[model samples]
Target: MSLKVLSALDVARIQLYHFKAIIIAGMGLFTDAYDLFCIPPIIKLIGRIYYVEEKQYRTTPTVVVSALVAIALLGTVVGQLVFGRLGDRIGRRSVYGLSLGIMVLSSIACGFSICRTRNCVLVSLGFFRFLLGVGIGGDYPLSATIMSEFANKKTRGAFIAAVFSMQGFGILVSSVVTMVVCKIFEATSHVSNGQIPEQVDIAWRLILMVGAIPAAMTYYWRMMMPETARYTALVEQNVLQAAMDMEKVLDIPMSQIAEDSLLPSYPPPSYPLLSKRFFRRHGYDLFSCAASWFLVDVVFYSSNLFQSQTYHRFIKDQPDVNAYELAFRVARFQAILAICSTIPGYWVTVYFIDRIGRVKIQMIGFFFMAMVYFAIGIPYKYFWSEKIGIGFITLYALTFFFCNFGPNTTTFIVPAELFPARFRSTCHGISGAVGKVGAIIGTVGFLWASRIPNNNGKPDPVRMTVALVFLGVVCLVGLAVTYFFTRETMGRSLEDNENDDE
Candidate 1:
């Protein structure tokens, strides 16, 4: 009958709780990024162990190798949808720890990817990684929704972006870890030529198993987190409990918030996403988030995950070299680029997201990404040339910077803020799921397209060029949608956005 009152959390000054929430939530993403990107290098290592060793000169088929890499995205897609809905229905904290536990167990299993044959080993690895993906996917909606709900409106964008920025560190760490492990193997293995043979199989396993340590470390902390006050108050309609939870989280006195007579009563919502009421309000928001995320991921995952393959393709025709040498080169390039460009771009978003607005950053990021991709595509031969390859590499690195500074960061931030508290996790999950689908498309499609045969049945640079151009077009389209349809949520309370839906 009356307006609902804001709690200490909704309008509270930025404080310690916000940073703790960011670190806890961000750590999940850090683990997610590490697990997801770690697979790419291992994919190369596996190929060397099986295909190249057996055939003496041949690599694995593109489709087979792509499946090994992209299967986790499929798992993540299903995980986001399932866990996201469960978080909304049951509660965020109830389902949150379970996801991390799944990740811990699955990461350990992924390390033990052994079987009687190469095909069997690949299958086992894919299966365990899919299970690991299920955990990583759940973290997306849970972490974003948790951070958004826990944060004050004034710094909410930067807080959420800060959590997502952990992804850059995850990626950087994965690369550094891979390089370190490779170097260690080279030192320890008795090979005189500095080649790490099957002895380095231990490296991939160690890398994957190490991912479990971080997830395990965070389990107690995630479980200790109180359910978000927003969900408790809005969806559960328990203002007293919500107030009590906020009091604990914010260290505020409860006597001030205990008066229930002033709080408005909310009937439970029954708005299905397809219903007219829901469609009229959030349909465009959902469409925009899902579509823009979809486009960004296709390029992001394809480029990041298969970076090694891109390098390998350039040298495919050169004189034969040991696979370990090739893997080292790929890891070194990826690590340097991630450290220099990718990680910084993410923090740039964190530093300015609340200040510049999310949609604007996304637009600028998409525009520059398109320009960079096109720059590489049109001069494909020139950039690929030994004389100017460094320039091309620089441009390629810029795409990573733009991706972090652009749609990749904003898409994750906006969905968590745009939806009603009742459906926040669900909508974020939907958008994240769509993005993973884009990742699958990018990974599979790019791998297939890059290998399309010419009249001579060799790797076609022209086809690869077309793929790069397509990435540029996708970014332009996303940029348009973002500029036209995406609403900015800067400096606004979550309740403000929720009230708009009513």
Candidate 2:
């Protein structure tokens, strides 16, 4: 088999295998999003169960809240760097199932977060969450690289975007599941005077445990997938294996296979990531991807992972609500927001990503998010006020819509499409890891920043002004970066994306 044949197959029209690859890869993302986002509600339960008596359930100390939110991000940074490089060294199919397995086990363990002491419970939950993050992080580079390698050039962006769009569904499902579970516990448990019962703990545990289901379900199919043909041929230099595998995937007859003699004889490129050849050719591309993803996530994760906190701003004056009530209300509202805005935005991207071009959609999405978020920030006090709280919720929902439609989806799509096969997973991992770093900063920093004090030492009305303004600026910077550094990958062959000779 030859490089040209593989490239031709890559750009060929879509096939059944493309959808298979999407389902196989997309399920992992669904599990990833469900596991990652589900943590917030569970953390709310943790606050209610463990900290409510301290009069700080809803107002858990910033440090404690930050730890719960940021630990998984730390693990993901490590996982992306580790699994990504390992995928290149070994093979994608070989190590692919490991991440899902980890996610399953860790998610279950996270549900059993109980311990002999309160301190032990925190340690146990945090440790499992971190491990879960590692698994979810591994899926990022692997899923993107696999889907990009499998997709046809004509619709590669849409395919990969569709895979990522499962994230929107996953998030929506998490909200729905949380709502149903909360309602079930409420209906079944013996509640006196509206006090939350011990059965409430079971609800949180069940919610956390459910994340393992989808991941475990997909593990078999994931392992059954052959190594992506690009990795087999380009990185491993096993043209025969690559040809046979792709033959099955594309249903190409043996008669169509290229002869080994005609294949390129040059050795696979093996430069270190920091080598001059790599730096000169792909350095700017690498930095742009990492920085843009980082900037988008800073706002993205903060808004998403801490969404209940944002919702609290609208209904904070509700008097005498217990922690479980607050948790249920937050999950219900989050579900509504996701159904109405988040899921729609993701589907719109899936519909138009290939048509509009990646660069244009991203820039437009960022611009709209920046403007809306800025508008929300400028009148922070007014929106937080009871008279205009609905107005604030409307504006807040728009940011989520644009985020899914724009940088959030585009950032994930581009890294998989823009880099060489050998370094594709590694580069994507680095970009993803950097994005998680920003997520950590966003989540932890926003927790503290949103609590800025006024002259009287009470929290100020303009507290969100600084954070939203910073996010809006970051989106603008993302727009500029996308314009200058990222090329549109609407119809380009993955091989064409490489800067080096075959």
lDDT of 2 by residue, 164-219 (tens): 98887788788778878877776677454336467767788889898788778878
Reference-based TM-score, model 2: 0.93
Q: Please identify model 1 stretches exceeding 4 Å from their true place.
A: 1-7, 53-57, 194-196, 260-266, 313-326, 381-388, 453-458, 499-502
For model 1, residues 193-300, the per-residue Cα lDDT tens digits are 424367767777887888788779888999999998778877888777877787787766787656557354656567675588887888889999999999999999
What shift in Å separates residue 459 of candidate 2 from its native position after superposition? 4.4
Top candidate on TM-score is: 2
Q: Considering only N, C-alpha and C atoms within 3 Å, which residue pairs clash in candidate 1?
A: none
Error in Å for residue 150 of model 2:
0.6
Tell me how far the alpha carbon of residue 52 in candidate 2 is from the true structure, in angstroms, after superposition.
3.5
> Each model's TM-score, in the order given?
0.93, 0.93
